[model samples]
Target: MGEFDLIARYFTRPVRRAALGVGDDCALLSVTPGMQLAVSSDMLVEGRHFFADVDPAHLGHKALAVNLSDLAACGARPLAFTLALALPRVDAPWLQAFADGLLRLADAHQCELVGGDTTQGPLNLCVTVFGEVPTGQALLRSGARVGDDIYVSGTPGEARLALDALRGRLALPPAALQQLRPRLEQPTPRVALGLALRGVASSAIDVSDGLLGDLGHILKASGVGACVDATVATNLLAASAQQAVATADFGAQTLMQCALAGGDDYELVFTAPPAQQAAVQAAAQASGTRATRIGRVEPAPGLRVVDGQGQPVAQHFASFDHFA
Candidate 1:
């Protein structure tokens, strides 16, 4: 199939939320009068983002999901997205599965696929997602303040554990691999949880790179320090990471590294004032996602990890950097 044929056959859909969808020179979006548009774009290259042999369906899901994660960080409800795809060849089955995966999540979030371009080139997928937040209510990393409680939605180390297993850096039991494969291939974006956190969370960020790394963005933006409870790190690992330590004999510290420094969790790391702790819990329960309290914002000016004994731990780990 050709470029236009590929788009029309696989991506084109009737207009739903957008004023104009596919086939138009530009997608016209009508932002709610009292809402501000929150937009983010993420690009997934074949090797950097996923393996060349990765399933196209999973790729499709992740291509858009990552962008949605950004909106989630800002406590925005997804509205629509544009997909720019570069493909070496048009494979019908591949395209069909990819579209199914992409549209499934889009439909779930009520996010529309509006318009994009498809061209022949190296395998690359870029998605620009637009969402809406109530005026003056969008969550910002700069909103964090001293004495805010730190929380993270769901587990963050599973995807990293899967990647480590695939790379032979760690060993996983058969059962563990089965459970972790999906976390690595297809991440669930926390859109509902983000929406639920609109007022409850003082500052929010999606855990795309690593918890500390991404949380650092909030700290730097807010100009506030944070104290991470090292003891809480182990409790946040997924069963896969736990199993890696359980049956594979990996050290507890190793699992902590996975939870703290490894990325690809796509969960939310947010902060709320101590007074809003109960509300944060309520939001997590409403969203059907588990939010774990892991740390607290401090009056100091730098990030620090504190041991169970309340002593500062000396360590360093960098998050995923594209050019690193």
Candidate 2:
């Protein structure tokens, strides 16, 4: 169908949170009183971000999920979002599935679809999400301090493991691949954990890049260092990854690679002083998401990794960089 028909058929909806929504040239948003707005935008292009054969519904979920992941990092409550999609051609089935997935997650988070544009071009989905956090309570990457404990919610690295398997770079059993595929295709954005950590977490960020790389953002922002006990890398592996290494030699090293450098795990990495350890755990329990203490923020200005035996392990893994 035509552009307006395409948008109306798949995307237009009544706004619950927006002051003005889809039909207008610009949607208006109002943040809760005593709260500040948090906004983030992300773009996903075919091939670079996802394979052409990926499920369209999941693609719709991810397109918005990644952006919501940003709001999660800021400990904000999602309010609304705008979607700008580029299409190679009009396919009703694909659009329907995509809209279903996107709207489902939006509804789950109470995030309304506000306004956006559609164009005939290569497949690309851009979403700008809006959220809000109480004044002076927003978690930031710059708040980490020495002696604070570093924690990650849920798990990390399974997505990269699945990607490697799908790319033929690694050979995994069909069952293992099947188990890991969803981690790569559909990621969970940790909203409740973020909201729970608001005043408890000294610093926070979501692990979109590899753990080290994304954690590095907090370190740099806070002008501190981190000492990660490599023993915890074992805990960061998803069940699928753990199973993949069960009988394999050099499993420890393999698991560490996935944990340290594998990106696309949308879990949260956060820090809090020693005193807040209990509160952090309480937040995790309240959110029903797992949280693990893997390291400590240090006074130094660089990152260091150490094995369980207290021996230092050199780290050189880099995170994903689209242009790099």
Candidate 3:
């Protein structure tokens, strides 16, 4: 089938308003009168992002989730998305499952799948999502100031643990394994929480890379520095340590490494000024998401990690790099 025919037949279904839908060079969307568009894009490749044997449905869900996570970081309400998909072959069942998974998340987030193109090529998927924020009010990486509190939503390292399980390096119970499996496949994008954080967060970015690495983006962008409390930062590791002391497979040090350097958690990493701290906490509670104050922004422009005693701790910068 032709490219346009494929999109019409498979990708384009009835969605929300579209002044100009598929079949044109561009789709025209009307934004809320007082809102500005917040746009973000993410791309996933078969080998780099997921194993070749990984479920196509999960891959599709993640392809959209990552982009949606970006909108969350900006505290934007999702509007629509355009997808560019490349595949080696047309597998009917695979396509159906993939679309089902993607649509499920889209419907949940109230994001419309506006338009897209499909082509025969290497297995790759790219999605660009559009969201809306009141003009001049979207959270930005540059808004952070010294003494702002740093926060991260949800837990980290689950996706990396799922990867470990997939590679056979980690042994988990069937139920635990199944639980971890979703981290690799269907990541929960912090959409509602992100929108709730709009007036509270001074700066934000989704943690696609590890916490340290992703936090560095904010530090660099805001022209500031930070010192994370190692004890608090490694809390997950401490818990795992207690569990592993009896089991002996996972170690505190190892878990700490994973929490520090593991990537793809897709949680929101944000900064808020002291004045907004109470509001931030309230918003997170209202959204039913845990927002941990992991660190504090500093005036100096070098990022550092410290123990409870304020001594600097050495950390290896390890996380996902598309090129590396």
Instruction: Order candidates by TM-score, high to low.
Output: 1, 2, 3
- Could you estimate the TM-score for every candidate? 0.97, 0.96, 0.93
Question: Which pairs clash in the backbone of model 1?
Answer: none
Show model 1 residue runs off by greater than 4 Å: 238-240, 243-246
Better of 1 and 3 by lDDT: 1
Candidate 2: clashing residue pairs, number: 0
Error of 2 at 251 (Å): 3.1
Determine which window of 10 residues in candidate 1 has minimal summed lDDT: 238-247
Better of 1 and 2 by lDDT: 1
Q: Rate the local accuracy (lDDT) of all candidates.
A: 0.89, 0.88, 0.82
Say which prediction, candidate 1 or candidate 3, comes out ahead on TM-score.
1
- Model 3 lDDT per residue over 1-324, tens place: 666656766677774666766667888899999999999988888888888987877887899999999999998998899998998988778887888888888888888888777889999999999999999988888888999999888767777777776788876655565766787688999888899998889999998888888888888988999988766646854464334344436655556666777788888889998898889889899988888888899988878877778888775657667778
* TM-score of candidate 2 to 2 decimals: 0.96
RMSD of 3: 2.2
Best by TM-score: 1
